[model samples]
Target: MPSNDSLARASGNVKWWKNANIFQIWPASYKDSNGDGIGDIQGIISTLDYIKALGVNTIWISPMYDSPQIDMGYDISDYESVYPPYGTLDDMDQLIKGCHDRGMKLLLDLVINHTSDQHKWFQESRSSKTNPKRDWYIWRPAKYDADGNRQPPNNWMSCFSECAWTWDEHTQEYYLHLFCVEQPDLNWTNEECRREIYRSAMEFWLEKGVDGFRVDTVNMYSKPMDFPDAPIVDPLSKYQPAGTLYCNGPEMHKYLREMAAILARYDAMTVGELPLTPNTKDVLDYVSLKDPQLSMVFQFDLVDIGRGPVDMMKLTGYKLSALKAIINKWQTFIEGNDGWTTVFSENHDQGRSVSRFASDAPEHATNSAKLLAMLNTTLTGTMFIYQGQEIGMTNVPKDWPIEEYLDVGSINYMKLIKEKLEATGASEEEKAKAVHEALLNINAVGRDNARTPVQWDSSPHAGFTTGKPWMRVNDNYKKINAAAQINDPDSVLSFWKRMIGLRTKHSSLFTFGSFHLLEPENEQTFSYVKKSAEGDEKALVVLNFTDQAQEFKLPTEDGANWSLLQGTQPVEDPTSAPLKAYEGRVFVNFGARD
Candidate 1:
């Protein structure tokens, strides 16, 4: 059992991020100021007022570092400089100042897990085996099989559907790349390399006045020393899923502590992206208040509810019961153990929340979006809103072909599927059917769905760029966009503003509250209560997860008079009325509880 003291300490000494409402901006799709078909820092600066009006106090911009664009800036070639397509250092400085001027802090995306092979460090590292920088990255000698053919160091698959180790002809050894071949994993075991990362990747930004970082793949900094082969998950595939071999290795904690010490000196906020964190106990080791390694972690249990273990493309129908279980597990365990986690349903890597978790049809999209907003705001953790989520963005149209997809993971997965089908000696008709199904899956769960240009207006390219856009804008932008919804009282954007304002007004109850789920077994409805640690403020959030109306009985206590704080549909008496289709409501019961 965990002690209550952790919760007490968390509530006592409040951090800035604990009460923050963060909004994520993917630069390439946000706004293209110069009409270059790519978003830039100047464009972000121009939109500060708009973001501030949404009641968000923090802005987390995705990677804008100089890169080859192979992984959309995740493969950084330079750490200290901004990508030329985005803007220059002067523009970044101005953007920082602009955010601060409007009372908003800025968080940059930190991609220290790997660097582009084009990076000077990696170039020097692969120059010669005796080079001083040779040990800066993971390198292992190739293995020989029974035959004369050479093999990679281990039978590990990359996240993008290929061998994890890439052969280097010049170095005569294979280098590790958990993602694309261009993105080489760094060696955190090297003290000098770690120090360089602290200076160039972290200290440089902090000194430049940025508030903090959204650490990419933070738990994967350490790797297993033995470099052993992973268990065969798919017999047809030559490589295997090896996340267990590298994720949360022995030195992971030491590396995080070292990074945390640097962040503490500047009082910087950090939210780590933990892809495969096993449980809440493991998450606590990184975010525990006793000796904080990170301010919070983005756990994937909620987003990964219906997805496959090794291949995310193998998705199944999402169940409300499973969602409820995940919520109960994380909310209760983290709250009890005094750990912190982020509350978000969408990001650059995920499809639109409305399309995934709720109905995205024309009739139910608005209400469903509002329902998600209410649920997210009333949760007991820091909130994060992805770009285009406020106006209820949906996934790409089903008619879109594979050519429109720009995400490396999506493209690679499609190729993998095609090859597998070919290997089965299937007929052309069967192969075509498989390809069509794969495209449908990509349309539903692909990263490109969220990477489309932000729908600013009904103009060409949604006013994101004057020139041809980097990717196609959502076709539904004509009816759903920021310009059209900014002032509409009944619009999804307005609902988000109101919900965010409500959370801001009662930060204590929503941020550090004790969460209690109501009717956890109910499949069509999700309801939960949040009570402040001081036992004063209380809020009840009820949501209809289905498209049809559902009856819900509110939890009533003596001397409690529940009043509507916000709702998707008007209800005179929530306890008695049936919840409308895709409806959501937040009710507050003021005064002491018996």
Candidate 2:
């Protein structure tokens, strides 16, 4: 457990993730408890000890709520109910109780941006415009283009693909679904909707002693009221509409403050999955403790490796200066501010960290992965570690076709490919390659990479389940698995154990210390120093984002030699002694130049 003093020391200011390291568990693939071939609360309960052993103080589970499962539970039919397939409410209760018993905290997914179309609330809203619940969703009267053709109310594009509007014959209007048609966006403008969603949903779990919430699609709550047609970016963009009109609306801060007030009653940790580019500071300002909209916001810009928007060709490219600038801004923003930040390289939505950020080559992959872990763990912010990250998982197989693609973003991109091909009169092969590359950009590094069943052993299912899993497990399980790495001191899993243990051990140095970026100009190699009032600490975070090892000079304090803190490929060889490919080193600054 982390020391109380360290937590308190780090608390007066908002940046909680700084002293904390959280492990994310994607339930469906973690471990199945009931021979039901799916993971449940019982499965999570079984792994509590294992998670505790890893030294992580918190666990953030993906959604396991009642849902159509159309979008893997993102389309929640019941915000307060647990999915029967995953487990009963009792199971969640027991798990929460058990987590508390083991001194671990639990964070549930907060998917309030939209609700499943099948939800009772949606059913009521869609029944008739005159119904009491009709105002619960964002439904608008249909408008006609110059051609007099019936069209959606606005040019709102779904994050999954094109337009966010879904035509409903009964209502004679389109309901908004920022992601999927099945997941209709709720109407925050409705007072009842806002109160019910926040108070009821929050109180449900807070009553059960859940400690925090991980908000989903947080920035999509507010939309433009104009409901006007959007200018065409792509004739197909007619589908998504002008998202800017609805995204980060002027009243978003107002709604957030309302929700924050309720969350504060229970002192629940609030983390928003804020997707923003220019509004980084503005977003933080809304959620900082001073305003209390939330406790923290996740930082994904570092992991959003695509050069612009979602381009695959630049996925492997490194912009050290850009990456440094991003982190530096975040560090400065939350340093003395009222809010905090959560650190991560990969998650259920991202490709495996080693595969996406690090080279897949065995010699360098795991090292690169570890270097990523070191950078976050030492930086002045909280950290989130995804499942299988500890063991260095890679992206999924590329053989999966459109039929196998389950993620909406991937499928939508597939549609876009076909459209582009037809519009440009390209060959079938060209179209397929374009779609595949786009898929590679979105889900290729591996949509299912993090979704692969947990590798617990060399046996079948890697000890994840006794029966077939909903998703396929990685083929490399035979060689790279929990059983094989648990005892290996040099294994990635062991290194993570070290990373977590150190944070808990040196909370004073790791959590409450001041953070400063060493270089803001260099783009490839990231270096920073974490300073404290009593003493200064430095860590040279050198990473080879490229495929090969490159020689470079890094500043080191005289007598403050660098040591391999946690990394893959050993940095012991003479030529690579100073730096290892995909490796990260933490050096203690002893003062004076080398």
Which of the numbered candidates is closest to the native, going by highest lDDT? 1
lDDT of 2 by residue, 411-501 (tens): 6666766776888888888877777666666554435567778888888877888887777777778877878988888887888888777
**Structural similarity to truth (TM-score) of each candidate:** 0.98, 0.91
Please report how far candidate 1 places residue 146 from its true position, in Å.
Answer: 0.7
Cα lDDT of all candidates, in order? 0.89, 0.72
Clashes of each: 0, 18
Measured on C-alpha atoms, candidate 2 has an lDDT of 0.72
Candidate 2 clash figure, as a count: 18
Candidate 2 displacement at residue 121 in angstroms:
0.9
Clashes in predicted model 1: 0
CA lDDT for candidate 1: 0.89
